[model samples]
Target: MFKGLRETIRAYQERDPAARSGVEIFLLYPGVHATIYHKFAHFLYRHRLFFLARFVSQWSRFWTGIEIHPGATIGRRFVIDHGMGVVIGETAEIGDDVLLYQGVTLGGSGKEKGKRHPTIGNNVMIGSGARVLGSFKVGDNSRIAAGAVVVAEMPPNSTAVGVPAQIVKVAGERVNYTKELDQIHTPDPVSLEIQKLTECTRRLEKAMRELEEKRHEDI
Candidate 1:
């Protein structure tokens, strides 16, 4: 348990440049505190102490503002930065080295019996305000852009952006250009579509001008 706590602290330090020291993280980081609470709650849940486990999870939510179901399976080095309003539902499975920013949700789309929530793969980075709904697998080394709404499964090493999330980059190495773990400058799908339309309009105008010049030459 101490080893896991130590590793969690280390992960926070490594991933977040704003973290000054281990003591600071232990004292001030609500994400870490939520993870610690979930560990014990998960243990109780496994032992069939459902009420107790839920109580702990609810208390953690009240304190941290991060709602993580006790039944959710979380692997090592899972980090949630600025973790307020982050929600991980029951049956959600999160792999190691996954990073999630604030306002991210791993939730079910509708009422389901089992395996309702999404499964997050290793080395995945989910940006702020992203909603990964339904029982889908977000592949390893993938990045979900800020405010993206992903309802389908994502392939490995892909970058998804926009509402209903479209893949922009795939089969490439993960990128970490800044310590803030931001995606503010990532390619915008809406802008790209506008640019394509602008180019098409320019070509049509040029073609009409050429046709007019040919008619004058014929005259």
Candidate 2:
């Protein structure tokens, strides 16, 4: 009700520092306006008023590029930064202190029913255009890299990156993805090192197989 509205406005202020006034936020920022309206629409949906809920949600989506389903359960202080084309599925459960950039989709991996959408943990950051699908769990305090397509489950405080997103590093690590929206750079030296290690493993396995054969022949 009024609580959600106040919270949404506060979130806008905390999220976007460039927002000079609440009037500017209400008028100019589509992201803020969209979230505010979605909150009411979602409430209506929970109360079994499906038709009106959908009408308001569709209206909000038309005005803003963000498409938040009324059935989706979003936590307090939820912020959609640059929320164009963000599609949160009906079954998606987003935890508190979560951040999502433009074009992020929390969708289903399969056609089955019952909790098809992804369950995101608290303090997690989903980068722009990242697609985290299925009923997988995204661990708390994790960062999903930009444009990553994650279908597998992520570990707590770990970072998932690349297509079919791999958990590259454990907790207490860092990734430099500054200005990635402008142009993403590949051939990362850090990941390249990991790739080289994988190649070395293959070579070692081949060498071990040859040695084992020679030893067996001698026997």
Candidate 3:
């Protein structure tokens, strides 16, 4: 238990540059407090103490402003930076070394019965205000950009950006995301589509003008 606590504090220090010391992180960080509360709540839930588990989870939510359902499965060294407004649904499963920024939601799209939430793979980083809805797998080492609404499954070592989140980068080269959070400057699919349409329109107009000139000469 002490080892886990120490590890959690170390993770916070590594991820957050502003973290001054281990004592400060352990005493002051809401994300750390929330994770500790969740461990106890999850234990109670596993023991079939449903009401108690919910009570503990609700208390944690109230205290930390981070809502993590007791039924959600979270792996080791999971970090939530600036964790306020973060929500993890009952069916959501998070793997090891996952990092989440503020206002991220792992939620359901509808009233689905089982597996309504997303299964996040190891080493994934979800940016702030990102909504990952539906029962899909966000593969290992993938990065979900800020405010991106991901409804589909993402493959390993990929980067997803924009609404209805499209995969912009694949397994070609590794990116050190821990160094910085580059939410902006990602490729915009909407802009690309518009450019393609504009080019097509110009080509059509040129062809039409040439055809009219040929017709007049023939007459």
Candidate 4:
């Protein structure tokens, strides 16, 4: 139990440098508390104490605002920064060195029985408010952009962004350039419309200039 507590604390330090103080991490951070509580509840779940385990998980969720089912399999060094509104499903499997931001979901889209949740590979970063649904696989070293809704499998070393989540870049290393984590710059619809209008105006001006030049030459 002491070892588990130590490991949980170490996970916090590794993920967030702002967790410099134990008191702050213990009292202020809901993710940290949620993980610690999940450990005990998870143990009970594995031991077939289903009723008690679920009860504790519900209590933790009520207090922490993070919903991580005790049955979910989480690897070592799993980190959730600003983990409010994060939800991990019952059958979800998360790998090592995974980074998740607030409002991330590893959930299902159906009423299936076995393996209904997504399988997240190692060294992956899922951005805030991203929903990775269904029983798909998010390959290793992949990045799921913020507010992206991914309902299918994402290939390894790819960066997915936009609504319905398109893989625009096949980033070999899956680099996270943005400190905000896993967020990619997808052309916003409103911004794209503005750009198109600006380009049309420029083209019209150029056409008018060419027409004036031809008239002057005729004179």
Whose TM-score is greatest here? 1
- Model 2: how far is 18 from its true place, Å? 3.3
Q: Could you tell me every candidate's TM-score relative to the true structure?
A: 0.92, 0.77, 0.87, 0.78
The count of backbone overlaps in candidate 4 is 0
Q: Write the per-residue lDDT of candidate 4 for residues 1-219, one digit (tens) a residue.
A: 666656666767766767887667767888877887788889999999999999989999999889999899888767788888999999999987788889999999989999999999988889899999999899887888899899989888777777787775564555542343426564354566689999999999999999999999999
Where does model 2 exceed 4 Å of error? 1-7, 172-219
Q: All predictions: root-mean-square deviation over Cα?
A: 1.8, 5.9, 2.9, 4.1
Which stretches of candidate 4 lie above 4 Å from their native place?
Answer: 1-8, 174-219
Better of 1 and 4 by lDDT: 1
Best by lDDT: 3
Across 83-102, the per-residue lDDT of candidate 2 in tens digits comes to 89999898899997677889
lDDT by residue for model 1 (160-202), tens:
8999888876546665523546667677878889999999999
- Worst 10 contiguous positions by lDDT, candidate 1: 171-180
lDDT of 3 by residue, 72-137 (tens): 999888899999999999999999888999999999999979989999998889999999999999
lDDT of 4 at 77: 66
Off by over 4 Å in 1: 177-180
